[model samples]
Target: MLGIGIVGLGYWGPNLVRNFSAAAEAEVRCVADRDAARLQKIHSLYPAVDLLSEATEVFQRSDIDAVVLATPINTHFPLAKMALEAGKHVLVEKPLATSRAEVLELMEIADRKGLQLMVDHTFLYTGAVQKIKSLVDSGELGELQYFDSTRINLGLFNPNWSVIWDLAVHDLSIFDYISSGKKPVAVSATGISHTQMGIEDIAYISLFFNDSTIAHITSSWISPVKIRKTMIGGSKKMVIYDDVEPTEKIKIYDSGFSVSSPEDMHRWLVDYRFGDIAIPKIAQTEALLGVAQDFVSAIVRGTRPISDRESGLNVVTILEAAQQSVKQRGQTVSLV
Candidate 1:
């Protein structure tokens, strides 16, 4: 059994602890939080679970075979590096690190130590997303044209990172996974900060890829109501994945544009073909739970996670570039 140590008991930490504790292959050995009151509260709920104030104490214990980091964005790099160096497998939340160099360093350390390093990109493990991946992989999304997404919420603001890192990272990771091996060539972005927090509350990012593929992502935390939707358009078909919907969460539309006749030239008009819309029977499972379970499986099988370090690195690399672009007033940034 993998003995796990959980760091940070803030917003997302408890979910990790609960899921990890429930996984059969792993056991939550201890949990650490800086706030003593929060630790007491957790101890009150999970009486048998060990709780501590200092995060370093978890690393000091030999019983911990792995560490799960649910800390803030800035703390991810150092905490993950420390955990890996302590000879423990590490699982960190999304955007693995703030910078590309930090990601490379973490990869090197984990590789040298022959340890597993996983990132919690929770959405990728979702039933809807997995089905979408299968559809794309099976050529149902044929010759991808563009990916457009809009993710907005009222306010779960962060002081460290802008809206791009806070919100668009999810779509970026999804696009990365869905696009397979396609690397983005260039990008442009713009953002606005409504508050005095010094970080952006809204942003729009455009990603340019080789060939005809391109993607646009818009994220904001200042919206009135939450909206989570993504559309992937292709030559053959199109897809609409809406998390806000209950019945039609994922709808694959067998409808697209087609040229009527090349001979007509200027007279020729684009045809709109509409056919079947499939929801592709999907299993009901919590995304975070699936991610936690997958982490354990990857550890046991000695395999890289689906949303592994490399995937997280790619997302962070884009985020870094986008941040730079935002600062430069949406000047096109090149990834190559």
Candidate 2:
């Protein structure tokens, strides 16, 4: 069994503890949090696991082979670097780091140490997304056309990062995974702050790809109601992914339009094909568990995971460009 240590039991840490506790090929040996109540709460569930007050203690443990970080956005780079320097495999929560330089440095460390460096992009492990990847790769959704997404929820604002960093990362990871060969070349974004923190609470991002493909993401922390929906449109079919829907998360619509022969150059006929909507069944499994399993397996088997450092780089690249675009008042930012 691979021994694991977790740091930061804030918003998303407890969930990681729960999943890693139940995950395959791994065991939570130690966990640390500055919040005494958080440590006590986790101790209540896991009496056998060691609890520490300082995060540095997690890296000092001799038995722990891997470290999982759920710290704030700014602390990811330093904590992960410390773990890697101590010869421990590391898993960090999304975006990898605040800037590309930090991520590249962490990648360099992990490479030198020959350790697994993974990002906890939990959405990439979801059954619905995995199914969507299959559909996309199988040519079920003909030539890719567009990816439009809206991920908005209420009242979970962060002082460190804006809505674009907090929310759009998910959609970008999903897009990067599903659209294999097609990558965005440029990005444009706009956002506004609604609180005294001067952090953006709402944003809109548009991505331009080399081909005819494009993507638009609307992310907000001010929505009255929660919405996790995405549409992947192609020439032959379209997909509707409603993450909030428990049962019918993925619905494939076999409907699209086609161009008819043009008798006159200016007057071309159009035909619309409306076919049946197919709802493919998705396995009901917690995505975090898959993340835990992949982390452990990659460490043991010496294989790069699905959410590897390279994929994490892709997500971070777009995030950096998008944030710059927002700062420039929706000026298009070149990614390449």
For 118-224, candidate 2 gives per-residue lDDT tens digits of 99999989999999999999999998899999999897899989998899999999998898635688999999998899899999999998889989999999999
Off by over 4 Å in 2: 261-265
What do the candidate models score in CA lDDT, each in turn? 0.89, 0.93
Instruction: Score every model by TM-score.
Output: 0.97, 0.98
**How well does candidate 2 score on lDDT at residue 233?**
97
Candidate 1 segments exceeding 4 Å error: 260-269
Q: Give me the displacement of residue 125 in model 1, in angstroms.
A: 0.7
Root-mean-square deviation (CA) per prediction: 1.4, 1.1
Clashing pairs in 1: none
What's the alpha carbon RMSD for model 1? 1.4
For all candidates, what are the clash counts?
0, 0
